[model samples]
Target: MDDPRSRILPLLRQGERLLWVGQPDPRVRFTGADALLVPFSILWGGFAAFWEFMVVTTAKEPFFMLWGIPFVLVGL
Candidate 1:
């Protein structure tokens, strides 16, 4: 049987179109871009690692099962 969810799911996942505007300076190059991206990547990566550790280490208990599993899964 054909599922009604097929059409509805596509629309639900579709995001609004966005245009990315670049920096105005022509002199800005790879080093400049790297400098900006590296710190953000490091910070986010550390947070993610710490978060995963908390989730996995705590998952053995009922409290972690009920709360941590879904919170980390969906990202509240």
Candidate 2:
């Protein structure tokens, strides 16, 4: 009996490019399957959290004072 899967393998191999379409392969994932989404989500979330923290802290401060003056004077 001839296997169709075996015939398809040669064509797949000859393509010479990798795409996430094969089954039982090492790179395949069905959930959170996209490679770029996880890292992008993490970076975006971290920046957003830092921005919110700075805004809230500044709002609660009673007076706006020079926090970065000494370093500026020393550098010049």
Candidate 3:
């Protein structure tokens, strides 16, 4: 309980080995990659939300909605 790693180590079985452990940095910084990824992620999320909303609200047969279910679930 004192350390998070203590809880994780017990779950490994025989012959299983952990190679490396690291903590995430707390600092937030913007970079060139973010400039491209941020917009795509936003557009994807918006589309997924709109698609799901339309499926639930308007569609009757909704076979096309099946195609978008995985994309909507992953986007959110």
Per lDDT, the best of the predicted structures is: 3
* Clashes (N, CA, C under 3 Å) per candidate: 0, 0, 0
Query: Mind giving the per-residue lDDT tens digits that candidate 1 earns over 1-76?
Result: 5665553555553684334433478875568778878887777666655666776686566654555444444432
2 or 3, greater by lDDT = 3
In terms of TM-score, which candidate is stronger, 1 or 2?
1
**Candidate 3: Cα lDDT at 44:** 93
Query: Which sections of candidate 1 miss by over 4 Å?
Result: 1-30, 60-76
For candidate 3, the TM-score is 0.66
Tell me the TM-score of each prediction against the true structure. 0.38, 0.35, 0.66
25: Cα error in model 3, Å: 4.2
lDDT: worst 10-residue window of model 3: 19-28
Model 3's alpha-carbon lDDT is 0.80
Query: Tens-digit lDDT track for model 3 on 49-69?
Result: 888788878885478678778
Please give the distance, in angstroms, between residue 38's alpha carbon in candidate 3 and its true position after superposition. 1.4
Steric clash pairs (candidate 3): none
Q: Would you list the rank order by TM-score, best first?
A: 3, 1, 2
